[model samples]
Target: MNVAADPAPAARPLDISTFREGGSLNARLRQMHEGLLERVPAVDRIACALYDAGEDLLKTFIDSTRTGHSLEGHEFRLSQSRSLSRLATSGDVRILDDIPALVQHGEVHSDWLLEQGYQSSMTVPLFDNGALLGMTFFDARASHAFPPVAQRDLLLYANLINMSISSELAALRTVVASAQMAREFAHLRDFETGAHLERMARYARAIARAIAPRHALGDEFIEHVFLFAPLHDVGKIGIPDRILLKAGRLEPDERQVMQTHVELGLEIVERIIGDFGLRHLPDSSVLRNIVGGHHEKMNGTGYPKGLAGAAIPLEARIVSTADIFDALTTRRPYKQAWTTAEAVAEMRRMAVAGELDPECVEAVAAFAPRIEEIRARYPDED
Candidate 1:
């Protein structure tokens, strides 16, 4: 009787949270895709294209495509397509059962779908609260594959995916906005510094994209760097007003105190992360690395930590180059703005001297035209 009673086996619990994880949005979306396939096998791709209202741009952000042909690094203005603008504005959900029929619309997206062999597509606008975020797309290889039943599942998955993207982005916006507010409250936000932060964000993004191929960096990493670049100097708020706002050169001892901002910045970031309950926010480490390691020289001659070369996080290396490039090209209280040529030459010299990452310096140099354009767009205090 005892032996017979020992024969019972436990049933494994049913699992459902497939996309819940602390990782890149792309990875989470792929996880969701895998889970969706279990119920709706016809769904071939799940993708999100994000909107940037500043430039009226909708750009490919992440995707999980079984076909392996994804539309990355592609962007178009939201106003360029009447159908898309209408959908985004009116919150209309689009179900194109015959994608080829859409070719007559002359939309680049329609043309791309045809070229990619996507036969059926469902598109819907994603929103955070009342504001439009972007669009979520469900594509299938077979026409009319998204039947009413499949449409119900796709809509549910779209909301799940949007919750993840919108929540993560909202967390990031909180961190950035809170830090900027602190700077503003402390009287540390000025026209020059504000403009510098704006330009640094773009410059960091340019360098990240330029070197992405060699580094295997994805769009997620690029976006985080762009968002966090400006916060690199946010810790200067901790230093004494005498030192931070000094009109003249810092003395050796004062310079030592000024250099403490790196650690100070890291502390500020950590405190913000903890206070906001964002300990698990994906890529939070990117912000920490930018604040902590941006000052460490490649030759081990730089600040708080003696991290050198590849020991420095790649994001930090990228931001350091961007920060230095902006500093060199921006007119400072103590120095005049250097020409773009002069800044690149100096960065090249610094790279050779092991003061900066060579690849990053080269990235900045390679992105000079864009750098000039950014400068023209967000020029230092006129």
Candidate 2:
């Protein structure tokens, strides 16, 4: 009998369940990445990129890396890449047993992966319902690390991650859709155009990016701020059409009624969270703060709560600044469209008058080039 009995693998003590944290998808991804490294030492990185169909683009969302740098700020259009487009179309798993074998393509993402010393990789297309949402990537330092059995393990993890992302986005869509329905039900004329929302989101992103470093904020924090910023005015659905639609300045009493929108927004947000069972949505306070506190001022003078200085959440402060900037620069029935320079001067004045956050105003000023680009991309309706 020449059959040599197989020796059992060494006993280990890595328990993934122990690292579980509630509520944050980003936090969960980090925990999963750490657990993956402990279970399979050769696997070195896990990352996700979210798709934006409106722009035909995919941007980095979250990642967990072991001895690898994050590709946090990377973005590319789906229309421009053959490989990613194929993945988007097929929604199949892609395996690269040897990453260096594909380096001849000269793609920026591949070049970066190669430079980072990853030798093998797997890419999974993520979806919510029938629509493509984004992609998840796993990279390894060792060639042929993701063989059949190992790939089965990786696939299970991929599905878990994709579900987390899908759940988060679906819950968010519910809130936004609810707000839209509320507006239509009340016959609230939708002055907040799709273009306005797009511009404001970008402005919020720029401000959040600038302030993040100084505040030790992660890309996920900036991501949440951008995600929730557009919903800041959802409460205006509760405002009366006369005050809301007035082509002239709001009268004193009308202004006071208009100020109630912030409170209304918070109520709508809370209702959506409760009714739809979205209480577990990650970073929900960010949503509440943006909607409930955006109108608060720095000098204890503004609306519903008069939250002065640091009492106002920084996310709200950022949104308010972005909102004001867009309102000033865009053409509205009640106000003339101010030039970029004129708007900047006015914002500076507002900051000095203690009506706006000075730091947020200054942060936005740092991105003058991007401001012009966003405006050009999302212009007002004729």
Candidate 3:
């Protein structure tokens, strides 16, 4: 009948500074596990079971203190133990001094308890707000009762752990959603140029990596360039079919209309930025800059904003070279595909004329063999 003693009033609130620092969820959970072990000295073994509400399964996720005993094949089924199931279903805490008695009374699994040599155990349900999340199990080998104070301290700790788990899940969901959107963006048929987008994106990453060290573009910059490259032609979604899908060379007026795709792409990207509220997100502005300025040329002849030199973002400059190289090297309805050698010669010509950034052109030339590999990797649409 003895219960664990209550913890001090000051210990009521669990310290959650580690969770706030922002890293992987599993790492944070492991830290919480270690913290609990350090705080509870008397407990010989601890096993945490998280109830996946969606799957309706109780899984042992964290285990820390088994020295002599092995729990390699132990199964703690929710349906097998009436007491544990009751605690989980009813959201209550049970502290037991006589573990064998509870099993004999049909509260827990008697055979399972004896096999593990568990004399005493504590089970506390984890919850956030009103919903049940999971439970924490604290066990000892000797027959010792939990004090009321200890029960209260364990409950508080369990609640803090549950809150941290929920927050981490939310962050993971955000990342997954962002990735799905990126995938959808990649598949859009706006460019209508048949794998031109994929080739150009690869080229963009290569150019960015080549120029990164010399231009002081850090790793973060290079990574963003790779991700944002696919969106270079995103504005083509807004261009009229007559301009976007044009098979023949465009007249002066038609060319002007086709040129509006860059502006359209910028506008579409800006709208996405506003909708996602990603303007303040780390490196988001850099991504947006790439989307908006990828078509700008080194010379003043580029469309939309007509940015020149360093006025164009570094990402955009890298993408511009990639986009043109892919365009020249790939077959279009209007022109036959150029050979790798021909593409390199054309790029060199542009570099010498200062129409394209010389560093990016050189990078493309250096990676010329890979360019053929890339073309083979993503074949043109027949």
Candidate 4:
């Protein structure tokens, strides 16, 4: 394989910062494709396809030039095209200067390409740690469009494309893994109902949105708070059932044991981070903070670290408000659920007493109307 560095005059170095990490994967992929097309004037179309390892098929991910019949969501077996398969396996860039040769040889998928007026094409393999992830196809109307000069630039562009895709893939895997962990932890507790989790997390998001400006929080941060909020009490699984499932108020020692759930939740999530090799992800800290610090108060009165006021993680503050709101409004074995008015009045009292973040409490108070909708949507079985 020819891996010559591009010696041509730099065509305004690729500004990868333009590809927003917070955007959807498809949007980022399209942005990269458009950037590549703007730089490489000879290429007419760029299509990125992902290899579905389970099915042994390459499915279309996104297409830059959807001219002749959209191949979006189209799939083809990897074994059907020998050249492409070779490129996929060998991690080589296949520059087909002639398309008719493959057509005359009855190569799979070639006839379709020819019918679409693509005379020549190039396939750049995308790999992550030696595993073939997929391929990006650059098609042109002219033959021999990808000569040595073009190949150098193409290879450079391919590297950029690989990084963009791989990062998004990693992000996707992290999201799935985090959700799976939350679900598994919730399952460990018989009392951890899904409806409660859903309601509380949304409440967290709402509070985050309200205080976002003051705290300089972005949409991504708010999203992480919502995603990780449900795991706030995940550590309860570690407490003995005698304490965790006790129907009545506990003794001081038993209450202390229950409070240890905060530390236990942090440890559980820390283990998950290590086990999944996601310790490098900054977003993972959101989970840890919520699990460990939600109990912390604004006046240095809460448990665990006794973090007070701004010392508490912003995410934990938001989850703290949401969790309290849900707990106050939802019926438990020990107490009857408070009415909306009663819950709001009591929350205001807590905020005044400095047990809760006043700003977060205000935010939740402002979003009070949505709470009923969420509650109705995820009502208890009774």
For model 1, residues 327-371, the per-residue Cα lDDT tens digits are 899887668999999999999999999999999888888878767
lDDT of 3 by residue, 43-129 (tens): 666555555442344545444455435232123457766777798778778877877665564433445556677878787787656
Query: Which parts of model 2 have CA positions greater than 4 angstroms off?
Result: 1-21, 104-106
Residue 211 of model 4 has an lDDT of: 82
> What TM-score, computed on C-alpha atoms, does each candidate reach?
0.88, 0.87, 0.53, 0.59
Arrange candidates by lDDT, descending. Answer: 1, 2, 4, 3
User: What lDDT tens digits, residue by residue, belong to model 4 across residues 240-270?
Assistant: 8788777787999999999998888777787
Which candidate tops TM-score? Answer: 1
Kindly provide the TM-score of model 4 when superposed on the true structure, using C-alpha atoms: 0.59
Candidates' RMSD to native: 4.4, 5.8, 14.7, 12.2
- Best candidate, lDDT-wise? 1
lDDT of 2: 0.82
* Worst lDDT 10-window in candidate 3: 67-76
Report lDDT (Cα) of residue 296, candidate 3: 74
